[model samples]
Target: MKVFGICGYSGSGKTTLLEAMIALLTARGLKVSLIKHAHHGFDIDKPGKDSWRHREAGAGEIALITDKRWVLMHEARNEEPPQLVDILERLSPCDLVLLEGFKRAVHPKIEVHRPSLGKPPVWPEDCDIVAVASDQAIDCALPRLDLNDPEQVADFVLKHVGLK
Candidate 1:
């Protein structure tokens, strides 16, 4: 699959942009999958849920299935978190994979930036950042995308990833 990433500091609208891009890409009949990296401890299962109970009972992995969907949850235990490439290999085939976060990964990424957030841009230090999407003008040599214009941003992304 063609892989791309959307990276930014906290509260910089990375999720918002990804939502828009997903809609646009899917509308074009492209099969897209996403892998999001979380910096904090998170859980999709509640304490009383069967999957949670199974995991608590020393089950290393659990697969929960319903008519609509299925999810596989694995415990990391003492092992280090899986690398990006390892996770990618586990995913089913797709035309594109949009990654949210994984700022330190060496994948091509678009840095979502907001000047009002008062956070420094990551592109200056991340050579994999191919473009910048910001609400306001910023000083940079990379291509600037209007954060409010999803179509424009999508165009740039498609072109950059050779999907256009």
Candidate 2:
């Protein structure tokens, strides 16, 4: 599967762009999957949930499945985050894989930037950045797209991965 990434600081609209792209790509009949990297601790299972209890009991991994969906939770136990390749291997095949975060990964990426967020663009420092999506246009070497226009961004990603 072809892989691409969206990286940005908090509140720069990375999740919004990903949500829009996923919807647009799926609507176009393309199989797409996503891998999101979270910096802070997060929990998908609640305290009373069986999976949560299993994890609390020190299970290394807990998988719960039902007719509608399935979830697998791995207890890190203070271990470092899994490598990008490791995460990719766990995912089923898809036409496209859009990653959110994983900024330090070497994958080709589009940096989502919101100037009002008070942070400079990461593109200046990260060579992995292939483009920038922002609320306002700036002097940039790479292609720039309006942050609110997901269709254009999705199109750019498709072409970047040679899918279209």
lDDT tens readout by residue for model 1, 55-136:
9999999999999999999899999999999999999999999999999999899999998988888999999999999999
For candidate 2, write residues 58-142 as lDDT tens digits.
9999989999999888888889878999989999999999999999999999999998888988998999999999999788898
Q: List candidate 1 stretches off by more than 4 Å.
A: none
- The local lDDT score (0 to 100) that residue 152 gets in candidate 2 is 96
Model 1 gets an lDDT of 0.93
Q: Candidate 2 overall Cα lDDT vs. reference?
A: 0.93
Q: In model 2, which range of ten residues has the least summed lDDT?
A: 48-57
Q: Candidate 1: deviation at residue 102, Å?
A: 0.7
**Model 1 / residue 108 / CA error / Å:** 0.7
TM-score of 1: 0.98
TM-score of each model, in listed order: 0.98, 0.96
Give the lowest summed-lDDT range of ten residues in model 1.
149-158
